[model samples]
Target: MDTEDTTGDLITRTGFHFHIRHAEPEDEAIVADFFKHVTPEDVRFRFLSGMKSVSHERLVEMTSSSDARRVNFLAFSPNETLLAAAMLAVGKDPQRGEVALTIRDDYKHQGISWEMLAHICRYAERHNFKSIESIESRENHAAIELERDMAFRAYTDKDDPTIVVLRRDFRP
Candidate 1:
């Protein structure tokens, strides 16, 4: 836990007694466990499909997938329990990034989602991404409200009934 990156920054930081860090391969199961707490309803809103349960194969794919510009972050409770998670994906173009976040159903409305989103945005900026996009179902008003704090250009999807795209540029 005391390992330091080449830049000399500590790998873990404390916030409200919780530890936030770049997730590792060993943390895959914990991420899977976190996904278990995310209900079908949550998936429905984000994926536009009512996914009852995620398969282990999918979990493995997510944790093992490698792209130089992609990074996943986890929020661990003081007890070292994964409470929430998010990912910052930089497109083939370094100037583009997109964030996807999810919080435990039981923990919703407690501000974890907002915190996770902010963390991912900051991460994206630190990596020099010029802009980030969030794709969500129009029915997910909470997500819409969350992005309202920033200026986003909205685009309607022609094929998807429940989807809308929001794009935001990161100002250094």
Candidate 2:
């Protein structure tokens, strides 16, 4: 599949292939629908809140934003089913960006998270970010381990004892 289109890019993993692309404002409906399949626990993990449902306003902001420093990526299965979503928010500090990743409820353990995080790392690097960080709840062992495996160092958040900051400083 061609990787040059604005619609999406087809990426092949070890045993499967999927399409990933930047989200557009028109994707608000689908992006909102994508949240329906995300587990409640994951929703909390993703938003760091007890949100049972993603608000329409939040979805709108995510899809409608034209900010150059903020990007949201969506991953879809070969059959065009949305599988995962990721966000990279670059703050004033050009040296770092904060990232978040979420997968559909039934798609866990499929390596999508790893691919998404790796892709985000490369994306951050290309944009001149020297590091990327993810704030994770301490209870989220799987995500913490995944980040550690990717060479991200875990530091106790200076302000939050209930969470840790996983940061990966890219090599210059």
Candidate 3:
């Protein structure tokens, strides 16, 4: 079940081998289907809005390979089922980036998010980024706890009482 592609690498987690690669323009449908499987609350947590469905243009932006500042990774099971998606949006400062991730509801509590976050962090550090950040809903306790366990500092977003900004600083 091992494979490789131009987008990125393949890795196994908990006996399930999956590909962790950048999303291609042709992957719009796949991403759309992945979003369809996400819960409403999960969608709110991921988008920070009550988005019941992702728009086509937003999906295009997510799948676009031309955006140098943004990198979106889609994880697929060995059988080619989309299991999760993670994104990194680097800022103009180069040393800081914002990250977001979502896993299918059925895949939660299986160490997938942890592995994806670790992989994304390594990717950021390798690209010379100094820190990675995520804005999470205060009700997203699972994600907040996961980020905290990964050493990301969490702070209340003053402008939005319902949001918490979590940051992980990488050592040079």
Per-residue lDDT over 95-150 for candidate 1, one digit per residue giving the tens place of the 0 to 100 score: 89777766678767666666666666666666666889888889888887887665
Q: Compared with the true structure, what per-residue lDDT tens digits does model 2 show for residues 94-121?
A: 6788999889988888778887788778
Assess candidate 1 and give its TM-score to the true structure.
0.80
Clashes of 2: 0
Name model 1 segments beyond 4 Å from true.
1-17
lDDT of 3 by residue, 1-172 (tens): 0112224444545655566888889999999999888999998999999777899998997788777788888888778888899888977787799999999998777777887788888788777778999999999999999999999999888899999999999975
* Ordered list by lDDT, greatest first: 3, 2, 1
* Best candidate according to TM-score: 3
lDDT of 1 at 168: 78
Error of 2 at 56 (Å): 1.2
What number of clashing residue pairs does each candidate have, in the order they appear?
Answer: 0, 0, 0
Candidate 3 lDDT score at position 105: 91
| Candidate 2 Cα errors over 4 Å, as ranges | 1-14
Top-lDDT structure, candidate number = 3
Task: Score candidate 1 by lDDT.
Answer: 0.66
Between prediction 1 and prediction 3, the one with superior TM-score is 3
Supply candidate 2's per-residue lDDT for 48. 93
Error of 2 at 167 (Å): 0.5
Better of 1 and 2 by lDDT: 2
